[model samples]
Target: MKKSLVYLAVGMLIFTICLGSSLITNQAKAAEEYKISVVLKALNSDYWKSVKAGAEAAAEKYGVNLSVIGPNNETQVIQQINLLEDQLVKGVQGLVVAPLRPQAAKTVLEKAVSRDIAVITIDTDADFEGKTSFAGTGNFQAAEKAGKYFADILAGQGKVAIIRGAAGDYIHDQRVDGFMQGIEGTAVEVVSVQPADSSRGKAVNVMQNIIQSYPDVNAVYATNDEMALGAERALKSANQAGVKVMGFDGSPDALKSIRNGELTATVKQDSYGIGYTGVELMVKHLAGETVASEVPVPTFIIDQNNVDASIRDLTKAFSRDRLEVLFGEDVIAEVFAE
Candidate 1:
């Protein structure tokens, strides 16, 4: 009986040792899977915040080490490049970036690709040949759809003014050009097209100037929601009524404005999906799988007719419980507040 009891004790000890060893092995493997870094254009806006939330959700789901960083604003092209360089020096295995100026980041992204790091672009595209994939809206197509809708609403006759982003920004250029193409055959005439550098304050001033020059302007279109909101403020301050205003990016503020009957309409891009898919593509690439060259997130028009439903969907998507599931308990409050 004593001999049998001793043998049982020895077997139990071995089993315990094996179990602990197996757990450690799994933990180590998980850590070794991938270390991904995401860089966004800016973190100062609701649209970018939503993108961050999506990236965080994807990181949790994939059980990967993820770090997201961004400049203070989208116009800090040099700063964005510097951030990308810093991440490269950190030896991260994967990189997802939304380049404020794609051309400026091409060389850095090329170096990353040369080092065998998976590189994915989100919200913008770079011409770097080594990029793994791009995840973003088809800006031209989405804007074209918005323009068509706007023209139909105006009965194909209106004097439209365009407020675009930075002069050289490819994304904004596409949107501006696409919108023009969309309104080509209609009776709409573009009174003025100007760049607001994508800043709300700048857009406000720009809109004020446009209003001064063209008091009879029938409508306005902005490349982004921030500028649209700015235009709305300018129009209200000037007491200019009956002029339709449309914006891109179905941002939280834009939806609210639409609901309140302040803004006319907006083209809503899936900002969250862009961030999520950018990281997911990097993961797949790191795992030796193929990813498409471009992954286009869908966009649609949102106005008073559907703003309420859209708000409901957004609330559910960003609810505390859902955010907790994606971002954990500690980060729930921070993300929810955003």
Candidate 2:
């Protein structure tokens, strides 16, 4: 009887050890399976592509499974919402998104939060509850700075027209309103404000119309580089000279335009930083670390005077050495090869 009891006790202890070992193994595997999804406003633009690159670098650094998806363009608000819903259905552990329309994303993002998924907004922000953090430029402040610069350059007096992005987009609204506020005390007159749906082609038509109505307009401010480039084209086509054009999102083409004295200046947002920080914050939040509600990336104005330096700085930011540092031995040599 005593020998039988000893055997039973030892067998029970063995079973307990095995169960604990299996649980630990499962936990480790779950950690390794961490998945993150990045949804952008659009993947068809250089600015969003830069953001994607930064997110890729961060995913490599953190050793997480990452997937990025987006609509064809920023105006496809419903498409973006549907994409987010699909990601949620996929049971993503983390989500980073640049909402085309914040309100449209609110309910879906709230659902994500309810599922215990960490949510971070990049480039554009949303007021959804339980959002992990926002990692992007302070649009209002940046646009205000651009406006003040314009006011100064135009000697506080000029006929200025504003070309906006998608109608009712919070990002563009903040920018347009901020620019208006910035020039309020100055003698600058806003001759027109029109929406281009954030499309370069649409902006060309809008600019042509503005030129027809406000033929003496001294300057134009576009909420984004695409629209600004279109405005510049329209101005050039019309033989309009000496009209300063300001753009946001200091994109590569916009920088080149500035260097060539086509576009006057642009507000340069840290697009890479926005992507990287969004992922970093999501990872940190998933790891149970506290993160700030707002993570403001840097922004500055780039123009003819600083275009060369800005280009050099951007080149260095994505140089081979920097890539190696960010991605370590996993960096693909061919991708950075001269």
| Winning candidate number (TM-score) | 1
For each candidate, give its TM-score against the true structure.
0.86, 0.85
lDDT of 1 by residue, 25-134 (tens): 87657645789999999999988988988898888877889998999897899999999889878979999999998888899999998888878999988898778889
Lowest lDDT sum, 10 consecutive residues, model 2, at 329-338
Which portions of model 1 show Cα errors greater than 4 Å?
1-32, 320-338
- lDDT of candidate 2? 0.88
Q: Candidate 2 has what TM-score?
A: 0.85
Error of 2 at 166 (Å): 1.3
lDDT of 2 by residue, 102-140 (tens): 888999999999998888999988998898899999999
Give lDDT: candidate 2, residue 112.
Answer: 95
